[model samples]
Target: DQQVKQNSPSLSVQEGRISILNCDYTNSMFDYFLWYKKYPAEGPTFLISISSIKDKNEDGRFTVFLNKSAKHLSLHIVPSQPGDSAVYFCAAALNTGFQKLVFGTGTRLLVSP
Candidate 1:
């Protein structure tokens, strides 16, 4: 069974608006959260990450929030631009030390002008 899943396969938003992506994990052992952005023919690039100890972590226009009690995490992008359109993947791990990660299928985000 997939431990991490993104229920919404796609999302659309207008330029300069906020976009929200969600992820859920079945494994309670997960204590680290990571978000990645991937473009066509390109490898997924790390966007942001959060430790289970913290409720939220923000970097520029990207923000990641974790709810340990609910086993859920979400990514928020403010003022999304057309260039921001890409596939977003969320991964869960026990800690950042190891390379093992359970990744969600991915959510395609489209930003329109």
Candidate 2:
């Protein structure tokens, strides 16, 4: 089963507005959630993460929210930028001895100028 899912294939946002990306998960064993940003040809870069015990986590202009009850996750990029335009992926992992992540299909965000 696809444990993590991103329903939206793409989204467009103005350069200064907030961009909201959403994701969902089906696995209760996932204890950690992470967001990654990727350029066209580059690998996904780690953005932010939230523990299963925490509802939200933030870093600079990026914030991630998690709802364990609903098995949902979201990422908010405030004041979106043209440079912020990229493919965003949400991932979930169970931390036992090692971290193995199940990633959702990426959502392409176009932060237009």
| Cα RMSD for predicted model 1 | 1.1
TM-score of model 1 relative to the true fold? 0.96
Return the TM-score for each candidate structure: 0.96, 0.97
Error of 1 at 29 (Å): 0.6
For model 1, how does the per-residue alpha-carbon lDDT over 51-110 read when each residue is reduced to its tens digit?
A: 889999999999998989999999999989999999999998885577798899999999
Candidate 1 wrong stretches, greater than 4 Å: none
Instruction: Give, for candidate 1, the lowest lDDT window spanning 10 residues.
Output: 93-102
For candidate 2, write residues 4-48 as lDDT tens digits: 999999999999999999999998989999999999889999999
CA deviation > 4 Å runs, candidate 2: none
RMSD of 2: 0.7
Residue pairs that clash (backbone atoms under 3 angstroms), model 2: none
Q: How many residue pairs of model 1 clash at the backbone?
A: 0
Candidate 2 to truth, TM: 0.97
